[model samples]
Structure formats: C-alpha cells, structure tokens
Target: MSLLDADAHTAHIFTGAWTRSGGGDAPVVSPSTGTVLGRTGIADADDVREAAARADKARHAWAAASFEERAAVLRRAGDLLQAHEAEITDWLRRESGAAAGMAGFQVHVAAEECFEAAALASQPHGEVLRTAKPRLSFSRQVPVGVVGVIAPFNVPLILGIRSVAPALAVGNAVILKPDPRTAVCGGAVLAEVFHRAGVPEGVFQVLPGGVAAGEALVADPHVRVISFTGSTAAGRRVGEAAARHLKRAHLELGGNSPLVVLDDADVEAAASIGAWGSFLHQGQICMTTGRHLVHASLADAYVERLAAKAEALVVGSTEEDGAALGPVIDAGQRDKIHRLVTAGVDAGAELRAGGTFEGLYYRPTVLDRVTPTTPPFAEEVFGPVAPVVRFSTLDELVELAGSTEYGLSLGVITTNPMRGLEIADRIPSGIVHINDQTVDDEAVAPFGGVGHSGTGSRFGGTRANLEAFTETQWVTMRADPARYPF
Candidate 1:
C-alpha cells in the first residue's frame, strides 16, 4: 500500500489520517538526482496549535491506560514496520537520498525502538522512600502529558521513532515535526504505524511544517517536553525556547566526533572503519566521525590507507547499492561542505582524496594535516570529509579532541583495549567507542551528548525516558490523621 497518495499536497498527519495542514506547498526532491518524488504542505502556526491541543486533550486517557494495552500497540506497530520493510526502505532511499544500507538500518532499528519501548513500559517507574514519620512514602512516575518530537532529515526514521515510541510507552501523547526534506517517510509512515497498531486518535500525530510550526509547538503550554535532533545552533534555539516555557527539552545536537588511532592499532582495520564512519550517509549523521586523530607514528600510513578505502567507494544515485556513499541532504549542505574543504586547504592542509563534486553528491574527501584551528577540525563538516590531524603525544590527542565545541562522541582504536579506555576517559563525550567508529545508537542506551552537543538528557532506557517524559509525584499514606504544628 502507498504510504501516502503521491499527489497529496499536505504533509500533516492528523490523529489516524492525513489532513491538509494550511500552508504553502513544496515539492519533495531527491538530492541524488533532483527528482521531484512528491509534494507536502507546510503546517502553519494554527495547524500546530490544533495538533497539540488534540494531543493534550487525549493525554490523560493514554496516561491512565494499562501497561499491557500500551505494549500491545507498540509491538504491533513494530511488527507492521518489519512486515512492510521493503516498502518503507524504498521510500527512505528516494525521499531521503540514503543508500540502501543506511536506509535499511534506520528503518529496521526504528522498528526495534518500538519493541524496546514496549519492554520499558513494564519496568518499575519509581522507588519507595524511607521516612521518619509513621507514614508510607514513595514516588510514582507520571506522564508529562504531551511531548513535542522534532526530528532532523539525516536519519528520520530512527530519530522520529526513537522519540515517539518512548513517549507513547510512557503514556504521553506526542506531536511529531519532521524535517521537510524527508516528510513522506519520516512523518507519514510513522503515522501509519500507530494508526494501524490501534493507537487512539489524537494521541499521536505528525505535523509537516518548518520553523514557524516548530516554534508554535514549543510555545504551547500543553507540550510539556520537546525532544529535538539536529544541528547545535538549532538545538540551542529549541532548548532556550523550551526553557523559557518551563518545558523539558532533550537535545541531540551537532557532533564533530573524533576517531583516534594509537601506534599499536591496526592501520588497515582503523582505515576501513574510519572510512565508513566518515562517509556513511554522506556523513550527515550527528555522530559521524568528522575528525581523525592519529598518532604521528601511524599518521602517514593511516592517511594513505584511509584514502585508498575512500577512493574505492562507488558514488552513484539511489539505483546503485554497491556504491558505499550517497548525496548529502541538498545543494546547500553540499556547498557548505565545499566551503569547509576550501578553508582547510587554505590553512595548508593537503587534500589527499575526493574534494570533487557532481551536484549534491560530493565524493568522500580526506584531509591531511588539518590544523586544530581550522573549521573542518574545530567544527562539524556534516559531509563526507574527514580531517586527519597528527598528534605526537597522548596529551596532545586529548587536547585536540577536547578543543571542539561539540562533545557528542569519540572513537579510540588501539591493540590494548585498556589503553583505548584510558584515552577515551580523557575525552569529554557521551559516547566513547573503543576499537570502533563514532556513528552508533541502539533502542535502549542513553543517547545524548554533552556541552554544545546537548542538554544532557538521555533519550533511551526505562529510567532515561521516564525521566525525560514523566513527572515524579511523592505520595504518602498514614493510618490515621496526626496532629502537627499549626
């Protein structure tokens, strides 16, 4: 079945159906070939208000629902997603410019998110507190009422579903605002999941809009929490707005995640993993390994090996899968990547491989001797550009990795796992991977960043989601009324 009618003009998902949100329409184009696959209407402020109001109105009933009832719906949604894997993955490729591997990973993991959330629904919510008085006191977790989920274009399915599944499992209604770049799969397919799974109308919705709509969602008093995934700048705005309204906001923002290579590490293995970490999905992922810190001893050989791996990658459109990389989200992103490349080169960095571009599909690029002060080193490239920096000492590796404004993730590769851990401990990051790449996430881990990268609110696990999506209530009981100071 069609996720949405191809000719449909609106991008809004209302309760159990697709509705015409009032706003200007825009054509959804593929960055790979500039093909207009579909069109979707932007949600105006009024539409956003209406959607949130609907979610708020139904919040109490969802919160009061039984755990088994909620779990069943979430499990059904996951099962449906798995059953329709081929259909959803295909749309992801065309609409999001994702390669087959990237698309499949997003969709499949998104389904698993729902299943994991179902498990979380049955876990203990709070703890009993010891009191001096002859009264029983304990805390109970209650739903936050309404959650606003704002997802980015890079990994739409996983990002959107990761937030939605947890919110629903905890019995809070959700309003999802997907990036216009991937609305069809991100917003519409998600709506179909809950609707077919028998989730109540108005409890879950998808509002297809841009900045105006997002502001509207955050401004509303009914939206108690906001979960956002995107750039650091945008995340700052979202966090500030949520704070101004006394609402909780979980931000999974930008990352210039670094991958380290020690002298003892396997240069070939590190090169292979680093190539994928830097170039997968054209390196738009927030956790993409944007910086490469190799010890001086291995730096020369590592760059050569890394460049060979990058050069071997096939660059083609969606029809091609043997090609490892795909286009960035759009031309603007492509231009931004090129500008960073130019800046790196001007700073005396050598372009070891791929600095060329054809449309939005910029080839996987490698930069050697990128200075610590350069944009590609200090900032996130968000493109398939890995800026390699040579570090002479362990202290220099720590200093270079810690210098960035972003502290989302880091990767350390060494023959000794303990050595990798010791170095990883020195870096400030939420995700520290040993002998691996930076881009990583699962349904049940605490997935957020530190410093400029996030608000320190983790997005997975029973405790994490409960903390993010629920309020704690201290309940007490006494056998009889006791006299107190008046």
Candidate 2:
C-alpha cells in the first residue's frame, strides 16, 4: 500500500505469461527523495510481439461480448479503483512527486474514466443510411483490434486509463507501456484492476520499460492503433512510426497555453487562477498556463498579489502533512525550469518571487516584464513558474498568445462575458476558457490541443474516443433489386 515495493513491481504482469526479455531490470526511484522505491522488468521485442499477438487474439472474444458485459467489466474496474484509493494516494506521490491533492484527484479521474467509458460502451453503434433501393444500408463502428498505449510519468494513472477505458469499451485489447519512473504504481495498477475485473490474461499487459520496449510495441504488427501522451519530440517519433506502418495514431503532445487577463477583470481572482494553473503538479501538465498575458493597467497589481500567493504555497514531499507543493519529477526537470526562469530575467524580465530550488522542490516562481520573445514565455517552461507579460490592447494580447508554436489551451478573463468570449473565440487554441484557467479536464468533455500541442485528436467525450478507437464500415444489402446496367 505504501510506495509500491519492488516485490509488488509489474514485471510479473509481463513475465507471468512470457519470460522477461531484453533491457533487464531497472530501479524506480522516488523523484522527491531520490531513494529507490521499486524495480521494474523491461520487455524485449519478442515479449512485446507476443503480447500484441495475444491481444489480437483476445480482441475477438472481447469484441463479441455484448455491450452489457463490457460495461459490467468497466464498472467493476472503477469500483475496484475506488477501493484502492488509499494505496493509490500513498504510492503515486513517491513515484512521481505528486502532491496529495493531485494524487487524490488523479485517482478520482482514472476511476471516473472507467465509469464514463462503461456508459459509452454501446454508443455510436451504427446509423441508418438512405438508399434509393428498398434495401438496408448503415455504417457500423468496429474496434481497431489492438491499442498500444504509451503513457508518460506525469499523471500516468489518468493518461493510461483515458486511452485504455475507451479502447476496451470499443472491444479492443490494450498493451500499456508506462514510463519507467512510475511503472509499478502506474501501469501495474491498471493491469491488476482490469485482470481482477474480468479482463482476459493476455487481453491486458503492463510493460514497465524504456525505449527498447516502447519501440517494440510501436513496431509490432498486431498493434492496430497507438495513443501516445508525451513530449512533442517523442510524439513526433511515434507519429512517424505509426505513419510508416499506416497505423492510426492519436497524439496528446506538448502545450504552451496562455492565460489572458483583461483590464476590467478581477486581478485577485485571475491571479489565483494563474497560480493554481501554473503551479499545480509543478506545472508539468500539458495544459499548464505557460504564458500569462495581462493588461498593462493591472499587470503590476496582479503580479504583486500573485507573488504573495506563490510565496505562501507549501513545497515539500507528500509525507510532510499539509504540504501543498511537492518536488518536480526529477532534478533534470527542476534545473531546466530554473534555466528558463534565469534566461527570462537576463532578457530584462523581472523575477518577482521564489526563484530558488531545494532538492527537486523548486519554489513557485513569478516573473514579470516578460515579452512574447522571452524564453519562458515562448518555450514550454513546464515547472511551477509563471511569466507575466503586459499587453496594452486586446489585439496585442491575441497576437502574443498566438506567438508560440504550441496551441493546446488558452484562458481569457474579463468582467464582461461577451468580451471574454470575443477573445476566446479568436485565440488559436483547441481549448478556450472564458472565465476559467487552462488546467481543466472532464470525463465527458473532449480534451486535446491544436498545432504542436497535439494531432487535433480529442481524447474524451462520447464522440471523440468512440470515433478515434473505431473504424467505420458501411454495409449495404439488396434483397430484390435488379438495377445493374449492362
């Protein structure tokens, strides 16, 4: 229940069926403490191939299962996850340095994804088509057979389940490759839940591994689709491989989202939204507010209030009770965030508050006088750092918000609802929030990004996943027609 011991590692989830292949065993250290928490077994090409083949085989029975049967399994998985909430809360923090609030929320979202997928198991079956002849014609949705889910260490539970739930609901087997950092607690948890919830042995596999295992899964012939959530560079590689194999790929890539504040908006409320959106999860989220564009008239007051709020946040390990902020995933990420913040200051931006790090725990940083060209503003400084830039006019803000290569999410704040809507409507982002911050995700809402952020593929909602994970086939029947021309 605590830290997911090496004895509880997910190696057996793969080796219980096939012998552990290449890449050998590796240790999973707590990102917050730098202490080894568990060990994970890596799968080789043969192992990945075997799992894919079995998944393909398993799909036939799972696909043939009635909607009610599939829904029952999913609902059971959700209930089981809820039962394991305490364990989840304990290990997720150590594995990935998630705060208590985040770890709890991640469990809630993962369980909810299972339930939502259960309810949508029977949707988008088939639609009747109009035919000239007195014959039946319709289009039906069919599963892609096998889904290769490659999830990141950040919020692995939510990311992995989001793909698995929908893929399984549509009657497809899933092969999950979780990041090595949180393998045991992240990937194994899903495997354990589904296996206990009635999914077949080979129907689901948890491979806690590195590049070799991931490459094997991607290159496997039986893998019909790939749902990848990670860095844009890595995602591009996955996209290329999927393209080479002509496999369907839905990518949830990087984001450099902006939170815009208008002159007439509430500065305190906007600052609170900004602090939470940027600092939550140490700003490791793809939908994190990377750029903060505020009107010049209120930028000073907003940054002043935001700095006080950031300073008050507690930064420590989850073990320390009441700690609001935890360490970053690793020292490397923390250093990179620090570098970005330093560069922004060198470029004439002002470091308003908390620009230091102790271990992996980087304090919430606030930067003002940032411009569209500033490194922290332009690049995805995915750490607990907020770059506040002043814009004189709405047109200026819109242009600054769109200056980045990424366009996953945008937030607009204004007293006038219509004014906020006007700005949100013009922003070049997949998700636009009129009064809310950018870090928002719902089980039923379609969630994704545009431009460099993603492949424009929505991951949630009834229509998005049902369409993404399935192939439509149009069938036509002619019983008594004789209309062929000679």
Candidate 3:
C-alpha cells in the first residue's frame, strides 16, 4: 500500500467491548506531513476496567496450557508478522513518522521477540534441589497474574513487543495500553498477530486511549504487574498507582544519557557514531545520547568532526529513500526540544551546527560548553539535539557523567580496551557501550536503567524475559514424613 492510502490507518481488530464513557476519539497523524490519518476508539475508565477484568478471566486458562502448545501459538504469530511486514512497515511509517529504515528496524525487532518468546516457552521448567535430609526440593518459575503494559510512542511496535511477548511467554495474560497516537500501528497490530497465532479470546487485549485508560488499567486489582515506558512524571504516577495495589511495577522512564569521549578515543569514529546515535529517530529515544562529555584537549576537534557528520544527515519523510532523519513524533515533543535548545543558547552554550526549527523538523543540533545548569544538559531533550561538555581529567569526566539521577545507558568512546573497561565500571548506567554510542541496543543484552531511569530490566534473552514476568516458587517433597519429625 502507498503511504497516502487512508485505509492503512484503520485498526484490524478490537476484541474488548467499548463503553459509553463519553471519551472523545483520538486522531492518529503522520508527523512528516502533519496530516490526520485516521481516528482510534478512545476508552474511558469503564472501558479500561472491563478489559482488565476480561484479561483476568482468561489468565488461568492460558497459564494451564502446555508449554509446547503456547510455543506453537507464538511461533505462528511470528510467521504472521513476517508475512505482513511490508503492510506493517508502511503503517508504522505513516503513524509514527519514522523513516522507512527505522520502521523496518522496529518490525524486525518485533519478529525476533516473538520467535524468542516462543523458544523460551518450550524450554524445561523448574529445577531440582537437594536438601540435608533425605528430602528432594525444587523451585519453579511461575507467571504472575495479569500484566499491564503501557508503551511509548517512539518505536512503539518494538517496545510493546518487548513487554508483551515476555508476559505471554511466562503464561500471563496481558493488558496493553499503547500510546494513543500510535495505537493503531503498534498495539492494534500486535493484537492481530497474537490472535492469528491462535491466542484464545481475551488472553491478550489492547486498550487504546489516553491517560484515563492508562490510569484505570494500572489501578485495576486484577493487574498484578505493571510495565511502563514513558516520561519521568508519568512513570511516577504509574508507580504510585501500582504501589496502592502493591503491584510489581517495571518502568523504563526518561533519560538524559551521556556519551564520554576520552583523550585516547578515536575522534573520527566517535564523532560518526555519536552523530548517528543522537540523530537516529530524531533523538526521540529514551536511551539516545543527549549529553556529550569530551576531554578538554580533544573537545574542539571532536566538535568539528561531529558538526561535519551531522551536516551530512538527510532530513525528510520516510517515504523518500536515503532519508537519514524523520520528524519528531508530534508537535508537543518538537516544542519541548526547541525550548531546551533555545535555553542552552541563552545560557551561553555555543551552537556548533544546525539549530533551525521548522514545523516538526528540528535540524540536527550540536551545542558546546553546556553546563549542568543548562536545560539541554540537565533535561531530557527528546529531539535531535546533542550537547557537548568539556572535562579536563578522567576522574572529573566520570564524576560529571554520574552526576545525573538518570542511569539508563551511557557510551564510552576510547580505543584502549583497558581504559574503556575502567570507564564502564565507573559509569552508573545499566548498560554501557565501549567505543560506541548509547543507541547500540541488541536483543540479547539486558536493556534497562538504574536510579530514576527505570526499575527492573528486560531483553537479555528469552530466560531474562521469562524471569521478568515470573516469580520463583519452591516445592519440597518428603517421601518419608517420619524422618523429619522434630
């Protein structure tokens, strides 16, 4: 289908019944052209409650199914996604305004996650333990109850799958609340694939709406776990609500990740990788390297090389080939980025290159001499902006990097393996890249953060995902009851 096709925006399936809560419909728009593609049904409090209850009802049956049976269903879902990759990619590009390459990348990640989840479900369950007495003890990982997954707009499809597949692999029913803007392409698509994979009705449901639906879902008693990815403020709200019910809350929140470039680093390589990591997805990623801390001696050269590389990036719609950058997800995010960039300039930070804002398009920005007091350096600038800070010594650089409350991810650029290892150890982030930027997230790595960035982790491998959704239960079998009489 062409990018302009209006039919592409319609949701394929919506299993949960809607209520008359008078919630207004939400319009899904294309960031590239700022045009409304279609409208999604918005669920109010009543609708959200009903969906949670439905998922709760389905949980026991799904959990009781054999592991092989569940695996078969997930594998079929993977096949379905592979079959419709092109259609899904087009919808993602239109709904999220991501470049074609980025849209494709998300689809690829989702497929991999589905396959991984299936393989994990087929693995052996429980382990045997030996006790001091003649008793056999073992522990098994069992799924928690219904999981509430609230996903973000940027890379919605990929992030949603990261939470949903794991919850399903562990035999837990899921209540997914995707970002209102990209629900059709992200949440709706996943629901369809899971259904095609033969997931029983109500086993997994998508609740599409705004904050009202999300709040209701998190507050529901049936939901035993909550996994969220979004702003810090919203994450706090979710965390607080989950706490009321004492639910297991896993949040991957906002980040102002740092990229440290030591004097021994390869300036050319660092500049190239840094530019890509910061500008990719227009820097909408939570793990995007928004702050750059470079050695004072190499600061000037690093800035020059980074500016040149940033200039080379192509900015346009995803439909156009070779477009390296795309528009921000929406106008609100664009305005936030612009305000931070403007604040940096006013705070005496030098604009090394591109600082123009036109509509949803913000030029790849590079600001130098940014301090902790500056908005760009301190805040989560979720746009294509990279601010550079200078440090005189390795100790000072490490201190500066760890100063932030966010510890999501950090990047270190140094050719010396020993120095890279030493720097990685000092950083507080959950995942640190050596001689690379923070955007290098792989499916096999433990992806999460420390401190305010998030709680708990996701996506190390199949076992990691399974663990995230399950709790350990110990079972002791005493063949001779009289032997242990006290």
Highest lDDT model number: 1
lDDT values for all models: 0.88, 0.86, 0.82
Instruction: State every prediction's TM-score relative to the real structure.
Output: 0.98, 0.96, 0.94
Instruction: Residues 300-414, candidate 1: write the lDDT tens digits.
Output: 9999999998898898786456767777888889999999999999989999999999987899999999888777998788999989999999998899999988889889999
Model 3: per-residue lDDT, tens digit, 1-486?
A: 222233432532255322223355677788888788787767678876777788888989999999888888888877888888898898888888788888888888888888888888877678998788677889999989788888989989988988898789779999888888897778778877887688888889877778888888888898888889898889999989889888878888988899989888888888988898799999989999989999999899999999988888888877566788878887788888888898899999999888887778788999999988888887889899999999998788888898888998888888786778788898888888887889865566668888889884755576667677888899888786755356
Clashes in predicted model 1: 0
What are the per-residue Cα lDDT tens digits for candidate 2 across 312-365?
A: 999988755788888888878988999999998899999988899999889999
Q: In model 1, what is the error at residue 190, expressed in angstroms?
A: 0.2
lDDT head-to-head 1 vs 2, winner: 1
Q: How close is candidate 1 to the true structure, as a TM-score?
A: 0.98
Instruction: Please give the range of 10 consecutive residues that has the lowest summed lDDT in model 2.
Output: 10-19
Off by over 4 Å in 3: 1-13, 16-24, 132-134, 480-486
Pick by TM-score: which candidate is best?
1
